[model samples]
Target: MHKAGIPLPNDQVNADDVKAVQAMSEKLWKMDLAEQRVALAVLISLCDCIVWWTQRHK
Candidate 1:
């Protein structure tokens, strides 16, 4: 994802996050186009939630 220019979570990210992302990426590559789109959409939604929560808390 970094190689693809996608920004990763920065604040408070830990080893588990890295492992999970790596694992997800491995599976993501094996997915068909439609499945990949859905996966990406879900990822985007998660990011949105993170951003919203962060802003609300700060």
Candidate 2:
């Protein structure tokens, strides 16, 4: 998997999580340049939501 350029999370990472991120990145990369930009924007938005949620919980 590492040879295939799959990304791994930190020391506490799980197999399924790595696979999921790999799949998401692959799908994003397969898009056209404009589409990929849009996809990335969406991803950033989602990440922001996650961060906000985590902060709220704290």
Candidate 3:
């Protein structure tokens, strides 16, 4: 079973939660354009406060 989203009711957050999200997001990125588009639509619908960052490589 997957436990990837939201804060636990017990108020415990783990590094694994962050890692799971990162892994899932990376997997979503590697999906086909059509699949990614669908995933993005779902993601946008679920967001309240969206934050993103970019790093340019030299």
Q: Which of the numbered candidates is closest to the native, going by highest TM-score?
A: 1
Q: Name the TM-score of candidate 2.
A: 0.50
Pairwise TM-score winner, candidates 1 and 2: 1
Cα TM-score per model: 0.52, 0.50, 0.36
Per-residue lDDT of 1-58 in model 1, one digit per residue for the tens? 4565544443443577887768756665765676566658878999999999999999
Count: clashes, candidate 2: 0
Tens-place lDDT per residue, model 2, 1-58, is 2353443322433567987767766765665676556655766999999999999999
Q: What is the Cα-based lDDT of residue 44 in candidate 3? A: 82
Better model by TM-score: candidate 1 vs candidate 3: 1
For model 3, residues 1-58, the per-residue Cα lDDT tens digits are 0243322223334567987667666665665676556655667865622433222321
Q: Stretches of candidate 2 above 4 Å error?
A: 1-27
Candidate ranking under lDDT, highest first, comes to 1, 2, 3
Each model's lDDT: 0.68, 0.63, 0.51
Q: Which has the better TM-score: candidate 2, or candidate 3?
A: 2
